[model samples]
Target chain A: EAEVAQSPRYKITEKSQAVAFWCDPISGHATLYWYRQILGQGPELLVQFQDESVVDDSQLPKDRFSAERLKGVDSTLKIQPAELGDSAMYLCASSLDVGGMDEQYFGPGTRLTVT
Target chain B: AQSVSQHNHHVILSEAASLELGCNYSYGGTVNLFWYVQYPGQHLQLLLKYFSGDPLVKGIKGFEAEFIKSKFSFNLRKPSVQWSDTAEYFCAVSPTYNTDKLIFGTGTRLQVFP
Candidate 1:
């Protein structure tokens, strides 16, 4: 089965350091999503991309976080000067299109820990 | 902005036991509902989804969910569960008429004993 691929499954860094996560969605998927999951909580959308264009980033903390999918196939999410509270599971998901009924395949996630 | 609520945080069951997980969303517009499962160390996988149809939808692994429009709810259920069913389940909602961004609820972790 085609699955989303994520690198650096785990990351540990001190507060004020920078961290990055990477994701490669299944081929032919046009919609990509980045989410953060605090322990014991649901995943919250940070950004959404459609064919290399950002569709929604209302919840993204632009001051410290940034994401890009230049080719619309693979993506990268970065957090500069990470804070203690920024520790969470960074998840990547992708789907065929924007319809809500489309199945979004998720990656294994990169667990970030800031001490 | 929309939100999803899952009342159960954790559930423990033995093999052959029935299972039900509650999920509710606060949205006034047309919506799509889904149930996703995550086994330990595995990625999240869609179990079922309800777009528009007869409220009841059946999914893989003997799982099903009912969408109640009036209640703004979609509840997942399984008549007989096995030890392999131990995993975390998440309920999500998307406002079809508005945006396609998926809003998820605090997940429910199921620990099934053999």
Candidate 2:
């Protein structure tokens, strides 16, 4: 089965350090999403992209976090000067299109921990 | 903005026991409902979804959900469960059909004991 790919399944860094995570969506998928899952909480959407163009990033903390999907295929999410509170699981997902009714395929996710 | 509510924070069940997880969404307009499960040290996986059609939707691993439009609820049920079914379950809702943004509930952790 075709699946979304993510790199750096685990990460640990200092509070002031920078970290980045990568994701490659399934082929032919046009919509990609980034989510953060804190312990004991459900995943929350951080950003959404449609064919390389950002559709929504209202929830993203732009001051410290940035995500880009340059070629409308693969994406990268970076956090500069990571904080202890930023520790969580970053999940990437993709679907054929951006629709509420459409099902999404999820990647294994990158677990980030800031000391 | 719409929001999802999961009634149970944690659940414990024995093997072969029936299981039910409550989920409700607060949306007046047409919406889409979904349930996702996450095993230990794994990413979230879609268990089932309800868009249009029958209210009773069946999903993988002997799971099913019933969408009650009037009640604004989509509850997951399993007649018989196994130890492998232990995981964290989340209920999510999308307010419209055009967007992929989803509002997720806190989630319920189910521990199925052998």
Candidate 3:
């Protein structure tokens, strides 16, 4: 069973510090997604990537958040000058393609805590 | 914009008890519905999905869901459950083709007791 890999299972940072999380999806997956899961709430889409190109980032907080998938393999999500409310579980998921209603496989999320 | 709603926030059940979780989506066009489960200390895993054809879809661990287009509902049901089934379940929807951005509803946390 191919599983998505994530780094730094847990993170603790100061409110004004910068934080970054990494994700490596299953091999040959062309579509990748980043989501934020607040406590007691479902995951929310932050960004979507097809290969190395971004497809949708309407919900991403561009001012402080950025995500990139170079060469369409692994991806990195960064939050600069994190705020207290930015603490949440960041999940990364991937699928075979952006179409065809493929099932997306998710990685164990990186839990962020800002104090 | 598409949105998913889960009626139950938390549910408790004993072993071998039947289970049903309500999920509704707000989208007029063609859509794909799915149910995902997250066990403690584990990542989200796909339970089942509804794309087309048969409205009733069966998934792993004896789970099933029916896609009621007229009601915009995709409710998950299981005839019998075990203590291992205790987990958080989420309902999600995405537009067919084009993009695959998923909109998920607030999860339902099920506590199955033995």
Candidate 4:
């Protein structure tokens, strides 16, 4: 089965350091999403993209967090000067389109820990 | 803004025991409901979803959910649970049927003993 792929399944870094995670959505998928899952909490949408253009980023903390999807196929999320509270599981998901009717497929998340 | 509510924080059960998880959404308009499960160290997988027509929806792994419009509830039920069923389940909602955003509830952690 075609699956979304994520890199750096685990990450540990000191506070104030910079970290980045990568994700490659399933082929032909036009909509990509980034979510953050804190321990004991459900995932929250951070950003969403439609064919390389950001559709929604209202919940993303722009101060130090940034995400970009280049060429509309792969995406990268970065956090500069990471904070302890920023530790969480970063999830990537994709669907055929931006329509809510289509099911979204998820990728194994990257677990980030800040010391 | 719409929100999802999952009342059960954690549940423990033995093999062959019945399981039920409560999920409620605070949307008044037509919405989409979904349940996703995440196994230990694994990614979230769709358990089931409800869009329209059927109030009762059947999902994988012998699971089913009933959507009660009056109560604004969509509860997940499993007749018999196994040790392998230990996982965290999340309830999510799309505020509007055609909207692209999804809001998730806190989640429920289930631990099944053998």
Top candidate by DockQ: 4
> Which pairs clash in model 1?
none
For candidate 2, list the clashing residue pairs, or say none. none
- Give Cα distance to truth, residue B93, candidate 1, Å: 0.5
User: What lDDT tens digits, residue by residue, belong to model 2 across residues B1-114?
Assistant: 788999899999999999999999998799888999999877688999988899999999999999999999999999999999999999998876545888889999999999
Please write out the lDDT profile of model 3 over residues A7-96, one tens digit for every residue. 899999999899999999999999999999999899999999999999999999999999999888999999998999999999999999
As for model 1, its CA RMSD to the true structure in angstroms is 1.1
lDDT of 1: 0.93
Off by over 4 Å in 4: none
TM per prediction = 0.97, 0.95, 0.97, 0.96
RMSD of every prediction: 1.1, 1.4, 1.1, 1.2
lDDT of each: 0.93, 0.93, 0.93, 0.94
lDDT of 1 by residue, B1-114 (tens): 689999999999999999999999998788988899999989999999888889999999999999988898899999999999999999998888745778899999999999
Tens-digit per-residue lDDT, B3-106, candidate 4: 89999999999999999999999977988899999999877999999988889999999999999999999999999999999999999999665467889999
Q: DockQ for each of the predicted structures, in order? A: 0.77, 0.76, 0.76, 0.77
Q: Which fraction of the native contacts appears in each prediction?
A: 0.85, 0.90, 0.85, 0.83
Clashes of 3: 0
Model 4 misses residue B76 by how many Å? Answer: 0.3
Compared with the true structure, model 2 gives a TM-score of: 0.95
